[model samples]
Target: MTSHNTFHKVVVLGGGYAGTLAANRLRTRDDVAVTLVNPRPEFVERIRLHQFAARTGDATINYRTLLGKGIELVVDSATRIDANTRTVRLASGRALEYDYVIYAVGSTGEPPASVPGAVEHAVSIAEFESARRLRARLDALPLDAPVTVVGGGLTGIETAAELVERGRAVTLVCGRALAPTFSASGRRYIATWLSRHGVSVLRPAAVSEVRQDAVVLADGGVRPSALTVWTAGFGVPDLAAASGLRTDALGRLLTDETLTSVDDDRIVAAGDAAAPSGQPLRMSGYAAGPLGARAADTVVSRIAGTEPAVIDLAFTGACVSLGRRAGIRQLARKDDTAVNLYIGGRMGAAIKEVTCRFVVAKRIRREADKPGSMSWPKGGPRPAGTVSPAETASSAGEVASP
Candidate 1:
């Protein structure tokens, strides 16, 4: 057995949005040693992965410049966590002992198990390699070949829109409704916009199976397709399950509102892998970034023997692109509920672009600044926004197409 020194080591598992931000935030403290463990050396801009699949944008970030100075980067996949020993075992047989651990291993694509042939024929955009494969398939297929997209959530909607802009014959398969999380007006706006672009929307129906060249629906109907994309759901890493931490059925680490694991306060979770108390919020970069920063604060407060500060959420806006020049900009409350003021068309697309850029910029800036010493910008009036109603009545009249 190897004896390890119990240093002030802070080990962050998974270098995606949450882990990256937490590591950067904690790096400012000279007393703490920061180590980031990830399967890859570079950071993946997950929100723009759809653009990458559409062959419109790159999805790689350089860790040398993006990681905080003095933070050790461990290029390894975490396979198990031994909370009792405060050690993480890696795929490479190495073990890392930590005083504090941030479990930020994000979610993976839910395997296409329910739909026969989907696992064998359909491709997902959950990781970089999968996106690359989808792009290659798209490039080789005839330009007009039909492409069917499964799921109507943000990712599914974004993927369908991007493919439509590529001039592909696309059919979106939504089991229930489009953008179910959005307001009724927002959903109708999205549906009308999709229709205007000549993309078919199949709602109240789901794909039961996917073949190499066709998708079978639950109602004994079929749609011919050259390619199928799955974005239905997400599953968290199993490391927590192996480590004996309390987790939900989907493998998400169960945490209090403070985002600390109920089993062990020394281990905290954030981002996609975390299920906060009460209803689960939509998994987005916006939520993950703040949660990461707050997790860092929680860790710092624990070390200082002070109360953890309550995280202050601010509503900026949410932009969903229909194509390059058209989209919807839904302004939201701090909790991410849609508000009344929304903009669509070129302006909305521009705003969406800016929002994506802002997420990247925020990460870059936080990595550049010293951790623990960092604080929010001073003296700005609180932004105005409100939570979206649980149910919104729709005003069903077609608006002018963008």
Candidate 2:
């Protein structure tokens, strides 16, 4: 949109949903040079990580296909960012200067060493490499091997359900109630589905430590587990914080309502790593696409010397796949409160499958074909004094609430 003849260099760190969206959409401008930096050459479908761990499908989309022409894709990691010099230092000993920077690095899983004795016994499918390792482990295990999944969040639920469907003996460990934010009816439905699949749900039970062949519970009870999959919570990379950018408690980059850094207008943020208005957003699908687009639009507006609108996101529903053939879609209020509306059983499964097929590139294609094709939840614009995403847990692996 800018009339300037000079090309603007834009460096996008991380190639997650938000990073991909920003890189692709920014290509709509002929005057901008978009360079996407990611550690892997392939695009990771983080949504299907559980399925990947269950040997359902590979969790990759060729980055070559996802990114359009004119966008440079760098296969490397950003080791540091020097805001004073406006440059990004990569792990490969290379550096790139940029007119604008997009911080879209998403959430990640911790290694076993992160938790007590977990490294020696547990596994996590938080990234493509880790997911591949999990799939390999699943392939090598016996059919009746007992696998315990820690965390009652969406990732834990999906991983537990998927493994159970594959005929593995599965148990879900939760520090609190399963799907605690969901409405009573929604929780009941989840419980019913999990029970029907023969998955053991251990609620009010916390895994104090993960052992090689057993899990030590908070109550001093030990449960035998041939395999342990950790899906508890996700944490963001410390790149922003390490680079001297202001970050929240969870290390998410702090931004203003327009999705730009409160300290530097040259920097913008979106996706899970963005904390706007002193509040952080949920690290789930609920915020990914919407925040990604808003961040891109803000960068574009800035280039064109126009003001970008404050990010206004809404909530509609979430789709969670129980297995290959069963799923649940939970609708919610604009503020993301669970409602009684839901579609369960085979129909919900079909809906979930359709949603999974939605890749980040499709969004770029839409933007190139349609100028204002942003999809908002519940028609967007929250009501006065409504709670924002900071108040709720946005697990990428969950969908239904009502």
Candidate 3:
């Protein structure tokens, strides 16, 4: 077993925004050896995954350009983690023991099996491989083939617009309000843009089932859809729960405000895979960087024999690109509730593009060049009646505070 007093061995799972940033930030201590384990050799710009599937852009970057010096990158999937032994078992049957592990495995777009045919017929734009498959399917489709995007969220909206820009007939089937997270004005603006762009918009229309050639609506109406893209929600990996670490309902590792796992201080959680105080932040690249940095800070503070600070990362706004020419930048309060203020059209599109590039080349790579350089807005106050992990564990007699 690795000893933190002499040298800290930190293992970061996943190479997404959170994992990559956490691994980079671990460079704050020269005595800390950082190893980033990922299934892919490169980093996926998750924010641009929609554009990637639409062939508007590529979403991968070489880890050489993103990882800091001396941080080892392991190209393997972790099958399970043994929390008792502080070891991660990989699919290749290799074991990696660590003094600390950062759970940043990120989220996936796998459609729920509850929706008949969705798991088998619908494609997802959430992950790199799924997006690649969606792209190949799109490439082989007729230009006028009708494509249906099922979801009112940013991913579905962006994907529908991108497909339309590629000269494909597209339909956005929002189970509820279009751009539900956006303010009323912002949704109106996006709706207008889509209407002008020749994309059909359907709201309050849920997909009961996704078939190969059509989608059966909740109203029992059938819409011809050559391709169906599901982006309703995301799910995190079961790594935490499988390892006997506590997780919230969505399988995100439950952590304290400092991102330390409830089960062990040696384990930290970040990004979409972390449920801090039973409340996970918005699953976007915007939140991933700050969460990743904070998780790294927790591990570093432990090695330095200091109390880690609580998370104070705030959300400023959300940007959604409508094709490459238009977008909506919806401003929000620190708590992430949408406000009336917003910017739309080409200006919004420009800002969204810059934000995407900044997240990768500037925000992440800058941290790689200089550890602990990443910063975010101070977060709002925690909600009332929020329970800390230690408190919850104590009440259940599962774990005692250190």
Name the candidate, 1 or 3, with the larger lDDT value.
3
For model 3, name the residue pairs that clash: none
Clashing pairs in 1: 28-371
lDDT of 1 at 217: 95
TM-score of each candidate? 0.88, 0.91, 0.95
Model 1: per-residue Cα lDDT over 1-402, one tens digit each: 222343368899988877888888885556778899999988998878888999888898898867878789999999888888889999999999988888899878844676789889999988888888999999999989999999888788889999898888999999878987677788888999889887899998888889999999999998898999998877777888888876766667766656677678788777778765523345677667777777887787777788775445554546788778888887765545667667888888898888777766756455556555433322222223211211111111100000
By lDDT, the better pick of 1 and 2 is: 2
Candidate 2 structure, TM-score to reference: 0.91
Please list the Cα RMSD from the true structure of every candidate, rounded to 1 decimal place.
7.1, 4.0, 4.4
Task: Please give the lDDT score at residue 279 for candidate 2.
Answer: 64
308, model 2: CA deviation in Å? 1.5
Candidates 1 and 2, the one with greater TM-score? 2
Q: Judging by TM-score against the true structure, name the best candidate.
A: 3
Relative to the unseen true structure, what is the C-alpha lDDT of residue 139 in candidate 1, on a scale of 0 to 100? 91
lDDT of 2 by residue, 1-402 (tens): 656558899999989888887787787578998999999998888888888888876688887777767789999999888889999999999999999999999887764465698877788877888788888888998999889999887788888999999999999998788876666777788889999999999998988889888999989999999889888777789998889877777778777777888667889998888877656556776577778788888889999999887788777767778888888888877777779888888998898777776545346456545434756654454323422334322212222211
- Better model by lDDT: candidate 2 vs candidate 3: 3
The alpha-carbon deviation from the true structure for residue 244 of candidate 1, after best TM-score superposition, in angstroms, is 0.7
Tell me the tens digit of each residue's lDDT in model 3 across 185-243: 98899899899999999888999999999999999999999999998888888888888
